[model samples]
Target chain A: MNFLESIKVAVNCILQNKMRSILTMLGIIIGIGSVVAIVSVMQGGQQEMNKTLEKFGTNRLIIQLNWNEWDKITSRDYLTEGDIQAVREMGEDIVAVSPLINYGSTAKVGKEKEDLLIYGVSPEHILIENIEMVKGRFINDDDYKSKRAVIVIDEKLADKLFEEEEAVGKQIVITAGSQNNTVTICGIIKAQDSALGSIMEGNRSTVYMPITTVNKMFYDDYLYAMSVKVADSDKIDEVGQKIIDLLHRRHRNENKYIMQNLTQAIEQVNQFTSTFTLIIAVIAGISLFVGGIGIMNIMLVSVTERTREIGIRKSLGANRNDILIQFLIEAVIISLIGGILGMLLGISVAYMISSLAKWPPVFSIGNIILSFAITTMIGIIFGVYPAYKAAKLDPIEALRFE
Target chain B: MIKTKNLTKIYKNGSIEVKALVDVNLHIENGEFVAIMGPSGSGKSTLMNILGCLDRVTSGSYVLDGVDVSTMGDRELARIRNRKIGFVFQSFNLLPRITALHNVELPMIYSGISARKRRKKAELALEKVGLADRMHHKPNELSGGQRQRVAIARALVNNPAIILADEPTGNLDSHSGEEIMAIFQRLNKEGATIVLVTHERDIALHTRRIISFRDGSLVKDEPVTKPVDAVDMMAKLSDMKDKHNI
Candidate 1:
């Protein structure tokens, strides 16, 4: 008659066969549980990737020489000092422009000589890439103005060279082309731990020198690539486009260089992660479908088993609505219980996996609510037909059934 | 009051139509105690089913309390059955899992009575049938006689106008069957109309009248000269209990 009484009747019916009810609920539990766990793991992984990407200065725009159409011209031979000045003049929000000239050579500190890449860059290189100084000061404008041969080394490279002794302000010999040069270490950058930060760390091991000195010593006029920093992160794309146009006019060719925005890289990663999450959700949804079928099967069996009970109730004036409500409520209770238990199990598993593997596990309230709604819908959709059949049974025929 | 004119029930099985009730006309007034006696497959059970609203008559005009029940829909028929008639079955049909009290309270539940009031009424019904002490017992825990008593209490819980019983004592021992018949006789004396179906002529002798059926038709309808009073037997038993103190 009332909602509470109907629920009571449904609960009593379920409790009448505890083992059967539990066994039926197990299908739904596994279906919902696996879905939540997989999605959480994927979400955690995406967050971890975003964190790593953020470490590399999401606003930092890389202006590398584009060789997509001009395959004959290499990135290492195309960029020049004149291009850097033209990009700087485009806007005041253009905070820093560091021209890069890279050379692979052997570096000798004391008797330990290691083959490493040497980067000839300006003082603004540290600011643009968001690199942190671990031990000593970064190379300053005074060092670049005087054409000072100063360098910064990562913690790993510093350890290799100094071996427990301080390496700052010490000379390390670099043999590039036919000329051998000795550069003083200005600072030691920290070793990066996360995946994206480690990429910058690997780049940090190079010897840094004044762009003027590199132009004078190496190619007399060449620049390889440039990294730029913008004042406002929101205006990165506009600033990047201005730099590209300025470079195109200065170089007299738009196809020679490419502007790679860090924002686009982050967007790509987001898209990839979202698609992956959707795929996992669809796979998990299949299990819920199977669980729905299982509920239908179990409900059918229940209707058949309780035919006589139906007859007795019908003869006692229980109407079709009563019978339908009773069976439908039984189904919903089973699924709702399974869904709650599944959510707990899934979240716990996701937490455990993330903690054990050191991965980011994302738990969003939206996903939890969506999963719950879907499971309950599955229960109602699957439970209706069997309940209808039970309600429509002929009381005489049902009573006659053994 | 009940009246059926030319009642016919044909059960179709594929291409074959079996006439379960054939051209039966019967009239039962208020507070009448009538027993329908027949052998197996004689359509006495079919007649009981139609009278109980568990089955539809193939062709008939049956009126209960002046309402044309034969043409009513399933839902309306269910309502009528709930408000006006109670049923007792050969198998007892008590929900096995619930206590005797809950089984008796079930019909009142469908009537939308409050739980507290339903419990009180159910207790009174059980006490009326002398099962007050065994209110909490399940069907399995009760003996045959006690189970039938519980069923009778259940039937009386709604205070329906008519009690339709199809072989109510079929599964009981002779003593339990007599005990059940005694309860029925008392219920009849309390002005409830009753129609009982039985193959045993001795069980039929407890009612005021007997209606015999054969080949899906009523063959005879006659009054019994000496009907048994079940409440008198109960009173005599209590008297014997007082006298057997030696």
Candidate 2:
């Protein structure tokens, strides 16, 4: 028979028993649905993480003190002003280097005392970290040269201290290590919310001031950490390694400080997402395997039920290949129908959950195609035995079957 | 034409072997009406199965229309059965879901005939069996005699050279059985070779010859006189229909 004719017959047969055909397709539907939903959610999470990381400035690198076991005996090792100069001298690709010093202190604004970390850094640090100003100006180079005690307070602190009033040019008392320092607020900085809202929490109640003034008022030895920005994101790793080697030589043959690339952190996050997606996929594959077995069971039952029909066709000049093709077509049809419905249901569920929970759930065409291909293969592989049994049935015995 | 030499069939059940046919030699010419009569379990069905190419002989050479069917593959045998022979079962084995027209068209489908031609041939065959108006009715909706006529139409649709009937009238009433026997007689007179298996001696007497089987062997083959004219009986029924128009 021609292709259309064969398909017509197969469709007619399936339509004759609609309930049985739909029930047989249910296994594949569930399998594909779960796979699509899980994978889309994972893809959405990964995209969200990438967006958050991108908001942190792609070319930025964080330089913190390692202080591991091998460097425990090294005395007084920290990122200094000279190390920042050396990192700038390494290449014209380096954009800016800002040394940061932070101290936990109590700030008093008209008897409302709050414990907060005051971050002291050059005005260039604001530009490098992509920080935005809400009101007034940040500490300029003149403030760092003159060691002026001027600070920038976040919007949250501004709101708490002055209610709706402007807080710029106001003086606040900061007490740390028995030394009470009064600082003029030069600017009101807007809080930065990361793509995933992680950094927003950190910027809620912090303050920023000139690093030179912080050095004079706080501990006089060395700064806490240094943040570096590069001109191009692709050179972040190379420039970070050069800075690390310079810091190691500057620390007198001790590589006590740790250099971390933001790109690397992003990579770690991506790896975590990939691993999580793989685990979910493995579980989904197990369910699909069970679904394939269910198909095989149903197909075997169908073959037994249609023994006389097979015999009649065989007696009517249908070859073994014809019988095999017929049964395989039935199996593939079940899986194809199930797969399509499952994909629809899965995407709908994913969309519902994403909208309800405010989580990004990405619908990926690759995942849809992969699920369909795998289900089709499952149908063929699991359908072979039953089809063979039907094809190999004895014509005489089958015809004699009631 | 059909010929069989030393035709034997032995069925195996685990360790036991049951011989269903034993060295039966038979020849059937074209355009002949022949009947095989025997009691149940007398190997008549087995012989019919072998003749219908539904079963393979254990050791024999059977030739049909110059083809060595004894050694033919399953697919080749199926092809021959579709194109060269038609079968009528005692139960009128029409597919339950299909109407009489589709049932009649089934055999031609396997013969690779076009749908239009198969429909035309099935309609002609149904008309020949006097079921032209009942083509849309399913087998269950037809009477016993009408169902058998539909089965006969199905058997004749492909214009096969041979018609094999295995107890074709076993389930019908005596009047319907006689009507079916008359149709077979008219088909034989029109040069369609037929081999019928029946237990009724009266049915056997209507055929030109009768072959009797017993204990897996042919016991007797004899010619019978007083062969009936099926066309004349159909004409008589038509005359009765005309007279009953009051």
Worst 10 residues of 2 chain B by lDDT: B228-237
Residues A295-339, model 2: lDDT tens digits: 788889888988987776666556677788788777777778789
What lDDT tens digits, residue by residue, belong to model 1 across residues A1-402? Answer: 446666887788788888887778776788788878878887776676676666556678888777576566755447777778877776678888898767667788778888676667788887776577888887788987887777777788889988899989899888768888888888988765564443544534555567766666676666667888889999988888788777777666656667787678778877987887788667677877777888888889989999999999999998898889888877888788778888888888888887765775778899889878987887799999999999999999888889
Q: Taking chain A by itself, what TM-score does each prediction score?
A: 0.72, 0.71
Question: Where does candidate 1 chain B have its weakest 10-residue lDDT segment?
Answer: B228-237
* Colliding residue pairs in candidate 2: none
Segments in model 1 whose C-alpha atoms lie over 4 Å from true places: A16-19, A47-55, A64-83, A91-95, A99-225, A230-259, A356-359, B231-246
Task: Report residue B190 deviation for candidate 1 (angstroms).
Answer: 2.5
Off by over 4 Å in 2: A1-6, A16-20, A64-83, A92-95, A98-226, A230-260, A356-360, B14-16, B114-120, B132-137, B229-246
Please state how well chain A of candidate 1 matches the true chain A, as a TM-score.
Answer: 0.72
Best by lDDT: 1
